[model samples]
Target: METVKLYVIVFDSTHSAIAAETMLKEENIANEVIPTPREITASCGLSIRFNIDSLDKVKNILKQGSVSVNGVYKLERRLNEKQVEKLM
Candidate 1:
C-alpha cells in the first residue's frame, strides 16, 4: 500500500463520528475510524481518518449529508514525530 498524508475529521460528538464512518463506507471512500489524536484536542474522542486523495469526496459527502464536524486536521509525521495541524 502506498502511504499518503492523512486528514482527520473531528466531531463534536461520537454519534457524528460514527455516522461519518458509515457515510464514507457507503460512498466507497477509503477511511477508518480512529481515536482522535492526543496531539489535537477535540470534543469527541473519536474521529474519521482518510487519505488525502479522498479529501474532496469526504468534504462533499459531509456537506451534502449535513454531518456536523468540529474541525478537519492534517495528520503528519516527520522524524518519527507526529505533527497535527488544523485545516481550514
Candidate 2:
C-alpha cells in the first residue's frame, strides 16, 4: 500500500465551494467535492480535496476566482486512522 498526502480546501459557504469546484474544473485542476471530514470542522459541509502537490496551483486559482476559503488542511489516512492538520 502507498500513503498519499491530500489537501482539503474548506470554504465558508456551500456556494463558494461549488463555485470553486466549477472554476477549478474549467482551469483543468483535478479535485473532488467531498463531505467535510469528521476530523475537521468548517462553516460549510463540503470541501474540495486535491493532492498536496497541487496546493500552490489551487491557491492561485482560488485567489484569481475570488473564492472565500475558510481554511486549508493536510489529511493523512492510514489503515483505520486518519489525521488532519490545518495548513492555512
Candidate 3:
C-alpha cells in the first residue's frame, strides 16, 4: 500500500478559500477545500488538503494570488485498510 500524508491549509476567509480552490483547479493541482478539523481554530473554518510533494507548487499559486494561508499541518493515513483487515 502507498503511504500518504495529508497537508491541511487554512484560509482567513471563505472567499479566499473558495478562490484558492478555483485557482488550484485551474492549475490542475490536486486539492479540496474541506471543513476545518476540530484540532485547529481558523478564521473561516475551511481548509485545503494536498500531498506534501505538491506543497511547493501550491505555495507558489497562493503567493501569486495574494492568498493568506493561516496554518498548515501534516496527517498520516494508511492506504490499505482492506489489506490490513484481511490480515486480521
Candidate 4:
C-alpha cells in the first residue's frame, strides 16, 4: 500500500472556510470542504482539503483575499494509520 499525503487548511470560522472555498473554486483551484480532523482543534468544524502540491498557490490566494487561517496541516494516511503534522 502507498501512503497518501494531503493538506488541510483550518480556518478560524465557518464563514471564512466557506468564503475561501468559493474563492478557490472561482479561481479553478481544486479543493473540498471537510470536517476538521480530530487531531486538529480549530474554531470551526469545517476545513479545506487540497492537494499538497497546491500548497503555495492556496496560501497565496488566501493571503491575497485576507482569509484568516488557523493553520495548515499535512496529513499522511497509510493503511489504517494516520499522522498529522502542522505545516504553517
Assess each prediction's global lDDT (C-alpha) against the native: 0.84, 0.86, 0.72, 0.89
Query: What C-alpha lDDT, on a 0 to 100 scale, does residue 30 get in candidate 4?
Result: 94
User: Any residue pairs clashing in model 3, and if so which?
Assistant: none
How much is the lDDT of residue 85 in candidate 2? 86
Q: Which segments of model 4 are wrong by more than 4 Å?
A: none
How high is each candidate's TM-score?
A: 0.85, 0.85, 0.73, 0.88
Q: How many residue pairs clash (N, CA or C atoms closer than 3 angstroms) in each of the candidate models, in the order given?
A: 0, 0, 0, 0
* Per-residue lDDT of 88 in model 2: 75
Model 1: how far is 39 from its true place, Å?
Answer: 1.3
| Per-residue lDDT of candidate 4, residues 1-88 (tens digit) | 9998879999999889999999999988899999998878765989999987788988888888978889889989999999999888
Better lDDT candidate (2, 3): 2
Tens-digit per-residue lDDT, 1-88, candidate 3:
6755568778888888888889999999998778976556645899887766877888788878877777667655565331111100
lDDT of 2: 0.86
Worst 10 residues of 1 by lDDT: 1-10
**Which candidate tops lDDT?**
4
List runs of model 1 lying over 4 Å from the truth. Answer: 1-4, 80-82
Error in Å for residue 86 of model 3: 36
Q: How accurate is candidate 1 locally (lDDT)?
A: 0.84
Task: Compute the lDDT of residue 63 as modeled in candidate 1.
Answer: 84
User: Where is the poorest 10-residue window by lDDT in model 2?
Assistant: 1-10
Q: How do these models rank on lDDT, best leading?
A: 4, 2, 1, 3
For model 2 the local lDDT of residue 5 reads: 66
